[model samples]
Target: MTRLSRWLGTAGALALAGLATPALAAGTQAGTTITNTVTVNYQVGGVAQNAQTASDTFTVDRKINVTVAEVGNATIVVSPGQSQAVLTYSVTNLSNATLDFALTTAQQTGGAGAHSNTDNFDTTNAKIYVDTNGNGVWDAGDTLVTYLDELAADGTKTVFVLSDIPLGRATNDVAVVTLTATGREGGGAGAMGAALVQTAGANTSAMDTVFADGAGATDAARDAAFSARDDYTVSAAALTVTKVSKIISDPVNGTTNPKMIPGATVEYCITVANAAGGAAANNVALTDVLPTTTTYLSSFGILMNGTVTGAACNADGAAGGTFASGAVSGTLASVAAGAARTMLFRVTIN
Candidate 1:
């Protein structure tokens, strides 16, 4: 066809504008083919001629982006010696292509946690798992995975950090942990892909890699990884016991400034105190074996949950306890934090 006006060659084609535009705000899917075609109209000697057309195509590059965010707003409260305490998180694949995300965890070394609580301890036996059931809670059916597999673009998965609280952790002690998700190549099933590398220079016909992730709690921006922090706080019962004895009466003194001697009545006060800022101690049980030199006062039985006045236990408690096998035993039901309760019993010197 004879053309009245001719278009530029490869140079003009390469300079074409608006040939490919981002399809979504997140990003166009990787490997998506975008084709641009232009047609030229011409006339020869006042006669219409066939149109000539040129087209160019390119694949959308992959944009690696992901986010790891803590799932809850508060620190997880746990007890001393508690096992399998959980800190939940979410990993979102915000890239234009499916990706495998490598997961890792770090314990904060004495700093503020995500909840702004001081991190004073480290958890033991920490492990990561994926919420295979989408229940948002870690369970036996959930799969333990080191990396998220075949997560598609715009997909999100719940993650869990399971750890054990040490036996001696104090109340209100905090242990902070961070979770990071690094993007990698996807497409292979049940296998982890290689790490992603950003394509240098300019665009190309083949799909390239681009890092679009922002900085996280523990990772730098554009590193193809994101991180978030969570914390475990201890809420344990700190208990202390104290025992004191007082002579109420003797056969010779008759309850007037009595002294410790044979046939004297000795009252034993056992006080159990729980420190403040700790959890309540429940089902508290106490037992004491009487000394061989003392005879059990079966008529007095025992006083439980008694009031302590002036460093001495008053007889204001309910009649509760058992005396058998030369020992006294009772249960205090519950003792709240920062509170003290006493169990009182009497014995006569043999």
Candidate 2:
């Protein structure tokens, strides 16, 4: 890219013509001023050859626009009593010039108009973060930046809209999260833009300094194009637990057709299920107190995770048991929504 200084001129001073052949592009951005000079040689009075130089300047003018859109536009599932959920969005630099963008978030409290889908509640401590890793999942390693590095025209960057949800939310509960962005002056630190603080030019103090990326006068978009907004919805997570007991062994019948008699070994199955209409359950655990009339045996049962069949028994440490006094307990690490998990513990009649 080339930058040249020139005296001011009227709008009609510049002209353009169609190129019949290919040419090299200087990669100049829209709203940029470019000045050019031409020299012509002529013979005056058929005696001597003289050369004169003429110059003209023009400004690049490409469409300046931006788009903010929710990713997938699907409802984000939240677990009952869950504290946080992550929504996603993307912002594309629609203008020919590079521009930085500052991010902000506003939660919706149910109302009429575009906010009609809101549920009269808002996510607390909401924030927006650039997905620096480019992965959709939010992680501790990702940095929270105040603004995006200058983005090139048609370039898109992903962001995570994260927030702590209000507790005690019922199943199917809904909340809205809106993300807003304002464009910043281009030339921030990145391949496509400017340095945050621009380099000093000829006669540094002769003219105003090129401000930091976000502090530039063009920080706002061109005209009304300055800002863009988009939003996503969140739901709740629910979980339930169930238990069943059956006779697995009896002294009278050996192992065939076990009877619920004294000295019979009883296998108690506890199921912690993720019911429908809620987000996936995490770190699920089941607790059962054994009947006083029975004695729990050490390491007696198998852990069937998520499903009753096809899945292997508790060999992977995903399920386990513990006993204290007369109580018997077992647990599965987790159960996803619409899924069920069962674990077994053995007890013998006292």
Candidate 3:
């Protein structure tokens, strides 16, 4: 027989010896005859001692049980930024056995679409979720942070809140995470006890949970509630310029050009205007830089009119007389806002 079988066989023989010894012994008393009472118990033995021999058989049953302790609460922190808040959640496992958990967030009901699983949570199986709305609690459709695979007894796990949830969404924005412990085989026997068998398929039901405050209760939730207050304002408009018109005479009306052989002369009129929004200062001057192609004419003169005043001239006038050979400069004297002025000049073309 194998070692295990030999050990069992020895134990069975010992038990039989103990049971049969008393029945086989008999003694006589001093004054009376002695009587012996005996009982026989039969069993099915593995090996027969002789032909028509009997043996003994016994049955043994065993079972195993597994239990999990409670899980510790989690703390969540959120950072401030324009795009999204970065949330961090820390949790601890208090159970003697390893545990598995998943994290999920509340969802928003109206307006824009919901947050996608890949975008919000780090993993699909079990994870942390950031209630982007900052309502202080999780609603359906919120983001999932991701799962923490396995946490050993008294171990801790941390999850990151990658994005900032906007403020001004409804209240109760929250960050949530769930940790679950699955019932598994333990030390003892081949069959499992009540606890393990009962939770066989619904392993996730033994989850430990944590949640943020109600809407507007936590910092994250308050920030989301007042997001609209941080908005900015902008304005715009158009600019325009007005046109000026005037006439110029080819020759002076009553003067002759001294440089020409005949009585030829030229007169030209020009208009100027302040097309911009502001007024033109009196000291702001106008100039006509004479070109090499133009010839000087002594009979020429310039006349000023309109909003500007100061210098005016006739053919023999002192203030403005004969065309200069080169440069010419003069001030507008004054020009009202959005107003126009005119000046006339007479000279032979030459």
Each prediction's number of clashing residue pairs: 0, 7, 45
RMSD of each candidate relative to the true structure: 4.0, 9.8, 27.4
For candidate 2, write residues 193-265 as lDDT tens digits: 3323333454332212232122211234333133323333444446666666777779999799989999998
lDDT of 3 by residue, 273-338 (tens): 554444243444556655554444544455554333333222231244224547554555655545
Q: Rank the candidates by lDDT, best first.
A: 1, 2, 3
Name the best candidate (by lDDT): 1
Model 1 per-residue lDDT tens digits across residues 154-206? 89999999999999988889999999999888549899899888999978778
Summed over model 2, clashes come to: 7
Q: Estimate each model's TM-score.
A: 0.88, 0.52, 0.23
Which one wins on TM-score?
1
**Candidate 3: where are CA atoms >4 Å away?**
1-263, 291-294, 305-325
Ten residues in sequence with the least summed lDDT for candidate 2? 1-10
**lDDT agreement of model 1 with the native:** 0.87
lDDT of 2 at 341: 76
Error of 1 at 235 (Å): 1.6
Which 10 successive residues of model 1 have the least lDDT summed?
A: 1-10
Residue 332 error for model 2, in Å? 3.7
User: By TM-score, how accurate is candidate 2?
Assistant: 0.52
Q: What is the lDDT, from 0 to 100, of the residue 173 in candidate 3?
A: 30
